[model samples]
Target: MEHTILSLINQTNRNIFLTGKAGTGKTTLLRKIIDTTYKNTVVAAPTGIAALNAGGVTLHSLFQLPFASFLPTYGSVPLANELQRIENRTSLQKHFQMHKNKIQLIRNMELLIIDEVSMLRADMLDAIDFCLQQIRRNRLPFGGVQVLFIGDLLQLPPVVKQQEWEVLQQYYEGMFFFQSKVVKEHPLLYIELEKIYRQTDPVFIALLNHLRENKLTEKDMAELQRYVKPHLGTKTDDNYITLTTHNAKADAINARQMEALKTPVYRYEAKIVSDFPEYMYPIDKVIELKKGARVMFIKNDPTGNRRFFNGKMGTVQSLNDERIAVLLDDADVIEVDRYQWKNVRYRLNETTKEIEEEVLGSFIQYPLRLAWAITIHKSQGLTFEKAALDIQSVFASGQAYVAFSRLRSIDGLRLLSAVPQNGIESNEEVLQYAANKATEGQVQQEWEQGRLEFLQEMAMRTFDWVTLETAWLQHSSSYSGEIGNKNVYKNWAQQQYAKVKELVATAAKFSKQLDGYFRQGASVEYVCERVEKSVEYFIPLLSQVWYQVMYVLEKVYYQKKVKEFVGELEELSNNMGEVVKKLFRLQQLMALAATGKDFSKETVSTERFEALFMQIVTNVNKQMKQEQLFTKDKEEETPKKLNTYEKTLLLWNEGKSIAQIAEERNITESTINKHLIKLIEEGSIVADLDKLFSKKEIEELSPLIDALEEDSLKTVVEQTQGRYSWDKLNLFRKVYLGKE
Candidate 1:
């Protein structure tokens, strides 16, 4: 079952929900997917700790979403009334101010793995959908990124305040992610793993299954009653961690036990280096431990020896600022070392043009935390050898089941109170959804069918020229040079852009023909033959045109002592270089597929893909760095070499008007105005209406710009005719749109 699901993830672009009972190796399967899949992927979870446990970032952190209850607005553009109701004016303003690099990350993402998705609210999922669409400029679900949701719907549930739910209920059927409006439009492929790896006792497994379905029998009740002991809560035990429903109860238990210890305390503070954010801290910054205190390991041992795993119960035998020893159940004492957790984000490597995870910072700390007691919510992915259940205050649907499932067997569980008849609860909505899940045979059938569709989509995408065209257009529009005649580079880029636009038209016609062939029930061999012809046609056209585009730029840079535009030149070269690499890879894949090879088990490796294009420049930025482009002018004091936006900003700060700066900088006034607007949009500089516009100008153009439905400055200028210049309209539009 796990093998089939893994194949679906790699061979198709389906949105999948991987669910199972607790201890069904869902996390194990997730690790396998992360290790082996060739797609550019991002992993996120609902909360910080869950994110830490899953080795990913938080959803809110990844999306830059305000911690607010979102409303399910239908398109990328949210309904104005509903948007105002969901978030405040300030947050909405901030949401639109995402950094350009973050926007690029969103555009480059191919797969998104959301761990512990049962705790993801319906509105939150819709908000993620909306965010991706707005940022990636694509309206497909999650901006055309395949999403994999991993969690048990029978374990943890999403948290929503009563007041928030009152407002959200009208827009949603329930709080789970399946109830999201977008998920309803494009339903997820449901695959559940049935094997239980945590517990092997048949009787215990039967009881858990009954509890999960809320179908407890009389025999199960009798077995559970045997562990009920009212006096157990009063006892102090170091071997068993107490699991409770509320944080306050768990905190009190841990605090009391800590205070009772008479041993001297050893205080250790975590070593944080560089850009680790406060919210994403995996463990407490400072921990105070005593010799006999109970501790729980929060991370798996870094060594392959597997001496200690997460949630392993032990007692602190000895500790210091640098070293600590833990005694496990079998009288084996092991020395524990500090573990480092890396905070990472996905980025496109300029040299390789591959999406890679870049480590932003790391937090080094001991992996142990107080294990006297823990809340059931925090114990979602943890397992225990012995635990006491204190569930009289259970509040959520699966609270009791989550607490009970943490133990290996009934022998490891001690009940502090008799289980109420209604304690083993399951949401009716979850039950109804689970009942409709396809059987194993049906899943296999769908998987086989999806494989062919996946091949078709891959072939279509290879023929689709939109991505390459967009890259060329963006590069051509943003091209700027500090040395030589800038028109030379600009004209060349424009010509290439024009060529790409023409190719886009030609590819669209070819794609339509290919679709017709597929619609006629063409065999794989027939389609591969068509793909082979297309590849042979496009390969020479792209390779011959783009092979020396970067080499020419390199030669131009080497001939001059230009330092101001080194970064910009490299960036432009890299953008074009990435396009060339992608085009070549697409052709290569199509050529390979023409051999009638199966792609289910093996896809194109990076090495093999690069082997096809090594004759082209492998790394445009490598030589630039080695030459030390900026060192020669270090002592010249050339105002620190500002970018176009920065230069425009500096001139403005010197009280120069837009026209004056344009004349001084030898650029168009419209380009100068655009630079300042870009600076304002990035929050680098604030716009002052009094400094930017005259009263007469504001009073005349403000109403017109405000009333225009579209926010494009060129559109506003066109409507007003040649009377008003684009520079004036651009400034007026920014102020009127409240971006200032």
Candidate 2:
């Protein structure tokens, strides 16, 4: 089945719906696709951490989509809340429309891989589909892009509010991502991943499978009750996690555990630099780091080393102004540095077809969470060695199941609720869906056959080039004469583009000479004569008239967005028609001038011209952003092109010493050193041997660095005690075996 799916991946037309229970190698398969696929692809998840785990961006970040719990700001208007909602909808649509880069990415993309699809609402999915259709200019679903959704529908349901769900109810069959309008209509092939990678014990696995399937027997419950000991040692001292249904209870437990520590709490205010939004900030704004506080690592170590995984537990050993020491359960004291969690919004460059990462902002701090206890909802994606569950408050269906499944074995759980009313709370809707989905094999087979038939019909049908069916295809031809065609589209486009350039050059020169105004006979006659004289240039152009054509081209040239001119020509009309229209527009402008029309009045002054230019350019520039011919024509007051972290990476790549980079960036050398040290810790940059220190020096210095008891600058400085300059050691470490 896996091999069949791999073969299916080679085809560009089919959407795949991948699902399995928790720890079922779904992420593993996605990682493989990301590493191997040659297609222009993107990865997005419903949440920030999920996106980070997939090495992608959030769906909201990718599409400029709004999380639809509307915050109204209205006073005294009739139906003001509804009006505000409408206004918000329009604004969000405009937001999506404005990001030309993102729009183009949607249009040009081949495969879009979305993780944690269950958390994705139906409206969000529709938002993506609508944006794609708008950008690609094709009504065929999702701009004809194949999307891969990896998530377990049985684990988590989309959190739709009562009113929102009421609104969405009319449109969708149900709230599952598979039930989303686009996915439901579009024949997505479901591929269930059967292998469970995390839990190997057959008994535990069977219980989970039964529980997930909503077929948990009375025997299973009795067996579970046997593991529910009255007391499971000292919970305060042990590393056992507690799962509660309510946030308040979890917070109380955490607070109680923290208060048990007699040590004074050290309050550290997180330094704000970048434009870090609330959604992306991993830790608390005011981080309270107390000695012996139980903390969980929020980020995986960059080097793919399992030493400090995202959920790894450690205790704060000590803290100071510069650094904090952490002691892990495995008898290792690792120096933790202030980590940077980026909230990046990505866009695909069409010209080069390279994916560019735009840092929206970032949260820089130690990736630690106060993890004494957490709510079951928050613990959805996490696994624990041992867990304590307070199932007395399992208000929602599947809540008990979710809390139970967090543990690897029945032995790891110490349930506080001795007896609940029902054996296991399962949603009736989910149970019904599971029953119906059991026969999904027939549905998928029929869907595939129908899909193949549709494609075959398109291939065999008589060509009516303008129809929506063939619009997704770049170019189409009549049924006959495959061999006789000599690339008409390219040939025609080039010839017409040349004509436009000539006409535009004349108009450009004439505009400057006229002191920004056109006169009726001499200049108008000159422009009109130029257009009338070119016979083949201004012929057979349809859809757009000459005024719009000439007006748009002049705007394009003036705005320095020349790369998108060809695309604008294509948008106006096809290649041959495009050139003719360009010529016609100049003729119309000349005629208007002759008729004493002051079309250039509001556009005469530089300020007005700039305003007019901005209006025209914003719309056209957005379209051009998708065309790979990118330019350096950045907008006024655009944020810094390169972020501080990106700049550090660039300077390091150029082989500039840390000091030189520090001087160039106008920051302290210590800051640059810290940044470089972070790169090393993340395992992104390895030390290059002999670049700063000899192999003998490295061998001698290895133990000295290790004896400091943590990978931190403060500890290193403390150990050296000013005998050796820290810069020498930093330089030495930077180039020491960094290449791997």
Candidate 3:
């Protein structure tokens, strides 16, 4: 089965879907395929923790989806402006160019392996399909791209509203459940992996199989009890065995399994389940912890999987009597009160600075550091070299099994204690969860079926006519001289026109498909129902296209042309004002008419109007003749030179104050004053002379007074005590009013 799956993945034109039980090496196979086949590949995990474990980016991040928000139901359809912007962006341009290059390089490629496919809701898959299709510009499924989907349908399904999921399920129903007859007809490659790799103990494997089949016998229960027994003295000397909530059993188990150091481990070196107090430690204490200081810090939130420095690593930077500053190699430096560090013991290395430099250098370039202690959820896609697991602790879920199975080999597994079976609930809880999911899936399937039927029917009826009309319009426009020679200009116009037609046709088709799919029955598979419900997803795209098309035709074609004409007239008026003055007058009349204002009743004879226009034209011609003559004469002469006072006045007019002129221009203040006085005497400048006490020239002096008051108040307020409130308030008022 594995070979078949691997072979399909290797095929140039095949997309493979693999489904099976958990611990069946689905992810393992995916990793192998990625490592072996595709070079320029992206491994996108659904969750942040999963991505971290897989050493890949998360799906949401890759899609640029809003964090913690529902996925957008409608696919992205770029507007003309947005498309242009995307074309201009260096990153996107590079990405597109690279993909084009890759296509040329490979000619063909291997599968796009998407692991945990079951966890992907129908809508999410549709979104992925939409993006791929758009980028490749291919009409076939996933842009005719080969995709490998691996997941067990029985496992955790997508997290979404049940109704939304149902809609998506309906849209993809046909593809989800490929009947043998249908499979033969379409020839879709499907492979199932059966062998369980993690639960190698025959007895253990048998018991799990029984439990999975809901056929656990009395012997099975007895075996489970025996398997769950706790081992004595397994905990490290410094590490205490502690339980949090029954829900955290998995975390406790994993925490206990971490390898213990042999270096005289102090009780403070480890903590079982301790909560770090927020804001209790001072900043200085955080900076005092030296390198080689062994420390174990507890993360209170089970889901808070901060990679580094969330109370994890410890290294000293500086120390004082009251506080110590410690630096986390990954997280920023923090200071804690010296009193807070009293309980923790560490032998500070004298050569801490050298060690710090070495450690900091190692991590200086990386974005984030590897986490020392991680939650089981964070361990999903990770395969550790060695893992220590304890199932006896609190809050253990089925996820514990999943985490344990992540290790590639059994030799890497270090069991801290026997796996606990006590908290295992009756099959009812698990069955209920599965039933709810299945029900949601059914709803989605029904919606998808309905949508498909509607699309098919609509395609046959309304869409055919719409598409025909669109083709005729496109043909007419192409042959017509309306489109110009510029490729960008022509393409932009065609796209605007085509988008509307495309939406109308797509909507009609979807409507027909929905009608056909749901007309038959309701007891369809959950996946089918989910796909059917996705019909609404296409509605927004249709609406946007319709609006955009109408806007382009009405505004771009009609209004934009009018505006362009007006703009050209305005430019001509500015350049050839005298000759084009009549054009400006006509524009004013048009503007008034546009505003629904009455025009003047005055009328001129046609001959008189023509004579006036001729006179204006003659005047413009005469001015142009004089300008040409003046330019030739000016070029033949030397440039006029300014006297020192005139030069100083020019600088002053250019916003150089007397003081600045003196300092920068290397002139005396008196000389600058003399220049200013001469300019004023010449009547080229205006000022109140006696008050020309630069400070007394009221209008000119106001700015300086305001500045002085502002500075004086600022100094007084900064130096003043609380008891001087009245004086400070007075100073503030005086400064604001420029009365100081």
Candidate 4:
């Protein structure tokens, strides 16, 4: 059954909910999938602690979302109040302000794994969905990214304030992630694991299953009553840790136990090697340990010998600078080594055009924490051989279940207080959902259907030009050149952008035609004919026309000798080159599909892509040389290219307004303004501000630009309601600052 689940995850793009009871190896399965999957993947968790446990980043940090409750912003429906409305607007604006690299990272993702999803609120999931849709520009759930949810629904419930729920109940069915609007519309395939590695006692397992469903009998109560006692052992006992319902109580117990210890205290400080943030520290920066203190292993043995595992209990035998020996329950003492945890961040590699993870820093420390007491919330994901439960005051739903489920067997459990029967049950809605989950037969059928549909969808989307257009737009918006060669390079880039835009529009229409054929149940040969025809039509346009332009840009880039522009040009060229390679790959795959061959894992070879790329480069170079040869023949009659600054200066001296000069020269007003700014900064010419803005407009904007807190032009435009364009504002700022 686990193998079938792994196959579904690897072979198809299906959204799945992978769940099981405690100790069912869900976390272990996640690590396996992350190591083996071929897709570009990212992992996110609901909170920082969970993120650390899952070895991923927080969902909020990954999405750049504010730590505020989100309400739906679509449609004309009003929010609960004006404050909520304002916050939603601000969050939307922040989304717009995301860095291009971060945006690209989200766009490149193929699969997203969310851990500890039981604690994910319905509204928070919706917020994540909205952010993905806006960033990827796709209306499909999670913007077409396959999502895998991992957590048991019976462990812990999402935290929601009473007032927040009062307002949210109008929009959502309940507070669980499964109740979110997106999940409700596109239901996830359920696959629950069955094997329980922590407990081997069949009777204890049956009792736990009954407790999970809120169906415990009188006999089960009699079994639990045996464990009820005033105390499990003395404070010096190393076998049991108190699981309380509140953090303060746990803290007090741990503090009192530490004070009672008369052994000498030894302080150990972690080594921070680099850029790990303080909030994300996995362990304490400084740990104070006594010789007799009880400790739990916070990390697994790094050497793979499995000498000790996370959550294993031990007592400190000896502490020194070089080694710390812990005595385990089996009367064996082993030296614990300091383990290193890396702080990783994602980045897009310009050379390979792929997203990769970079280790920002590392935290090296001994993997132990005091285990005298711990809160039930933090006890999640930890296995215990013996636990003393103080959950009589359990306030949250499923808290008692979580506390009890952490134990390996009924024999090791010691109840310090009577179980709170009212809070010991799962949510009724959750029970119904679990009962109605699709059986294995249904899931297998769905997996077969989904694999077929995934192939067809991938084939159809091969013709889509959205990614190409997006890459072009991002590059054009961020490209800037040095003053010496700014105009020439800028103009060339604009011309290429216009050409790419036209090509993308044509590609969009062709894509829709293919979509129509698929909808109309066209013959495989007919669809292949259409696809082949598109290949013939688009290949030359891309390789010969588009690649030729890039070729020219490359030549100009080198001829200009501008060092700062090289990185930008390389990025843009590689991005456009990837589009061409994809097209060639599409043609090959279609050819294979026409013959009824399996092309599921097929991709165009890099050798073939480079052949096409070099073919274009060679032809373009030959043509340019021929043209230059012809120019050399007519050198006497040819005119030298005028410097852009001198030409703009001539126009400025001729009493031509900025707009008129821009129109006559066939350049943008913004470009013209940039030219003027360069001229002023170089002390070439300084003239009228009246032609650009009226006296009242100038007076109004001058003070705002002067007194502005930040050096942002976009801020200036926002304050004035965009009445002034970016070009005019930039020109004014240059003049005001330079003159003063």
**Highest lDDT model number:** 1
State the lDDT at 489 in candidate 1: 71
RMSD of each: 19.2, 28.9, 25.3, 16.7
- lDDT by residue (359-404, candidate 3, tens digit) is 1001001111122334454344333434455444424334444444
Q: How do all models score by TM-score?
A: 0.76, 0.59, 0.35, 0.73
Model 4 CA lDDT for position 526? 78
The per-prediction tally of clashing pairs is 0, 10, 88, 0
Ranking by lDDT: 1, 4, 2, 3
Please, what are the lDDT tens digits per residue for candidate 4 over residues 1-740? 76667657655679999889888999999998887665668888998778777878889888887766677664433455634432343355565568878887887787899999999988888888888888888999999999999999998899887767777777888989999988988889988888899889999999888888888888888888889985654256747899999989887887788888898888889999888778878778988788878888988877898888888899989987667889988788988888888877677654334457778888888889888888898888888998888877878767878888899999888888765444265689888888756778887887667754664576667767766777667656655643665445566677777787888898888888877876786766777777778878877777654564566565666655556556566556766776765666566655655675543223323456677767777777887788888888888677767798888988988988888899989998889988988888788776456665678978898889878788788888889998877977888987777552
lDDT of 1: 0.78
Candidate lDDT (C-alpha), each: 0.78, 0.61, 0.41, 0.77
Give the per-residue lDDT digits (tens) of candidate 2, residues 428-508.
Answer: 665554443323465456444543333222222211123221221232332124232223234443444454444545434
Cα misplacement distance, residue 279 of candidate 1 (Å): 2.6
By summed lDDT, the worst window of 10 consecutive residues in model 4 runs over 597-606
Q: lDDT at 592 for candidate 4?
A: 57
